[model samples]
Target: MATTQTFICFEQAASRTDRRKNRRGYLVALLASVLLLSACEVRLHANLEIEEDESGTIAVVMAFDDALASMAGPELGDGLGEMSAQLPSEWQAEPFAEDGFNGIRITVPFESLTELQDALTALTQGESGSDLPVGELMGFLGDIIPTREGDTFRFSLTMPAGMDQALGEELGPMPIEASMLDSVFDIRMSLTLPGEIVSHNADIKVGDTLVWNLSFADSVRTLQAESMLTSAISGALIWVALALAVLVALVVVLLVRNRRMRPMAHSEQVPEEG
Candidate 1:
């Protein structure tokens, strides 16, 4: 009986040791996962909406994964605040949270395409005293200035093929690996025009909106879209001209009929006198 009780005690101790080992293993894995996620996960979206009068707004939203946001803690909020403070007076910014993402949304309104280009240039080139990940990625997008030819509007953007090398040359050595840049970051852009879509090299097109998911590649990547604006005034003028022509034709017909009837009535009355 004494030997059997001793064996049972040893088995119980072994089981307790196994439980502790399993818990430690789980803790280690959880920490590693958090670190990996926090190291590389970001999403950036930029949208440009142009009105019929060529005036419009540009909205840029930059968000991070929930794990990354939680890990960054107050530092992320502080960085966004600093960025907002540095923006121009016309630019507006507010905190954004959606679909488990935490970030900021910036809006800039422009009166013309030229002004829009200027705003985009400032956004990509302006100096902000924060190390926000979105800033460097925005620099990768080349200048996007839309042109107007009569009733047609067009714009094209070429994504640099050698993005990592260019970034290294312009902004010094990058901390993220070249191969991992695409996987770690997601960049998307959409342009909403005030006309019917004529042609576009976008990944998705919904009516007048063209969306492109940007990525780094070995060859030149070009995104071009053209739209033709329909003029309401021209349509109205055509209808007015048609109505006036119909009125003139009706007046001529009535005058001819009246002249013929008067002659007939005169002949009839003169015959009775004869």
Candidate 2:
């Protein structure tokens, strides 16, 4: 009887362990599904506009398709509200609904390039004290850091490696096939600088804006753009040119005055001699 009781207790424990494992597996699968859905059903657009002083505004819009909105239900609104609440007090977040899509728009204004870089880094790394899963998922996209060299501003984005491996390690295998990612997952980014765009490897150029369309089809992607800003040296040279023009004009006026006086003096001398 004692042996039988021990066996029964062991079986119960084993059953409980199995149940726990099943629950864990379900949660993991759910998380993976959410991520996959976000990738496929969400569209992200980010634009950065910088002034001559390096002060800029970053506008980011994340829109969800009908499928994602339906799947998320009311939880979508709650999640967006939570994300807004978690952002820094200075950042602006607002609800956005347009062209059959609904989502949120966040506008971040920075007084310097450093602040802009920090904001981008925080969003990509999910270090902004937000529990939003999108932030974490954005970590795999890549990095955007703008640098200034005299009159030129350089921007480069390089996609990181090991994204699939990282996802696999965390969530086992990807629920969605890799081939579908290209069709469903796309992100558009645009940058506008204060001055002329000198050179860029962007997919599209519209006036002063350089646009890049990114997708998950490639393991690695690189984007680069260089723009020339109005430098102090250029301003100083302009001022110098104006000053030289003024000086030349004054010299010409003096020469004319001297010539007129010489002719008058000659006529006066002739009258005195007569």
Candidate 3:
């Protein structure tokens, strides 16, 4: 009976040891699985939009709309977040949108008003041949014209006499120049991510709504582009230099001509002969 009881005790101890070993193996496997999962790589998506306001100012707006929000907000945010992170030199963000129209508003100022006007003028040159209505011209050049406290200039657009339906519909309201973008403006982007249940990367898996506003201030204070100021100075200097050179040449020519044209006075000779 003693030997049998001893044998039973040894068997129980062996079973306990085996169970402990099995438990340790399971724990190691669980930890290894967790490490592998943590090492998993993730990929993000890309979607964007671009727009502009009046006043010949440009605005680039990028957003996912609603279709992309179905994926994951973190991924969308990460993808757009990279735009800020990567192109740090190109643009920056301010306190942007919280939801709905999510994105940034990038405003490019009109440093050279003349240049902007000229560009708009050129864009609408085609309209000169078309028989567009009178009101449309105001809409087209509204942004191009400059306004201040006292100064105001009104312009009328004259189109070719004949008119047609096709031309009217194709060309909507001439692009308006919005004064809102005079000093600074905004570009907005909206991104939406869909929600998911029981995701491993829960933070990145849920639907997210991100909207940011970006500003482009005229930091240089002056335009770097070829402007009327440079052109005017260059032209004035060239003409002035030409005028001076021409005047000097004219004076020299007149002096030489006078010397050649002057008749020599005959020397008064007292005749020594008498």
Candidate 4:
């Protein structure tokens, strides 16, 4: 009877201890995900190769600062790993690391842009039709922008709202200092375009490759400003407006000439009465 009671008491204590640790982990993750910000240096380089048939391959390679992977704990890394694992098996062949950076290189094949879009949406959001946690955690990553021109592809990443943007007055004190987090993290991007790329607006352009020279901190600031700038009318629209203005001016000059000529004709038709 004594042995059985002792065993049960020990088991109960162990279970309680496990529960406490699990609670701690939950609190830590919740606070971090909700209050604290992700590291600033989250770099993703996606290489796209599209055929004339709209079928192609896409390789999304991502890397981050070691300090970030270490500090953010397994939540950050595991989230990333989960993202890569969720991809189709055939395309998950690339090694997850290169040089000194911690990363995952996912190479996927697509039958069409629509198919690719579905895969991308899944990556950002996750597979649907289940109660499981598919992609809720990734919502905090950032705004991922992808622009495609033929076989050329570009992605612009911005940190999450509360994490990087200029905060509004309503949001009370920030959970973490920007400067402190900024010092420990950084992000950059690059792309390997297909075919002979003769035109590009990237900071770093080498043959067919494009790269952004800005740091993640600088990148977010610049991108926000860029967003504001691009909201205006495009250059082509401005040119169209100018063309309309010129046409209107020419019409006004023609009308003035016709009116002046009409006066002369009316005077001459008065049979020189003066």
lDDT of each: 0.67, 0.66, 0.31, 0.46
lDDT of 3: 0.31
Task: For each candidate, give its TM-score against the true structure.
Answer: 0.65, 0.65, 0.22, 0.43
Q: Worst ten-residue run, lDDT, model 3?
A: 218-227
lDDT at position 199, candidate 1:
87
In candidate 1, stretches whose alpha carbon ends up further than 4 angstroms from where it belongs are: 1-40, 127-133, 140-142, 169-179, 232-274
Q: What is the alpha-carbon lDDT of model 1 when measured against the actual structure?
A: 0.67
Better of 1 and 2 by lDDT: 1
Q: Compose the digit string of candidate 2's lDDT tens values, residues 14-35.
A: 5534433333233224443554
- The 10-residue segment of model 1 with minimum total lDDT is 23-32
lDDT (Cα, 0-100) at 195 in candidate 4? 41
lDDT of 2 at 36: 59
Best by lDDT: 1
Give the per-residue lDDT digits (tens) of candidate 3, residues 84-105. 4433222333323434434433
lDDT of 2: 0.66
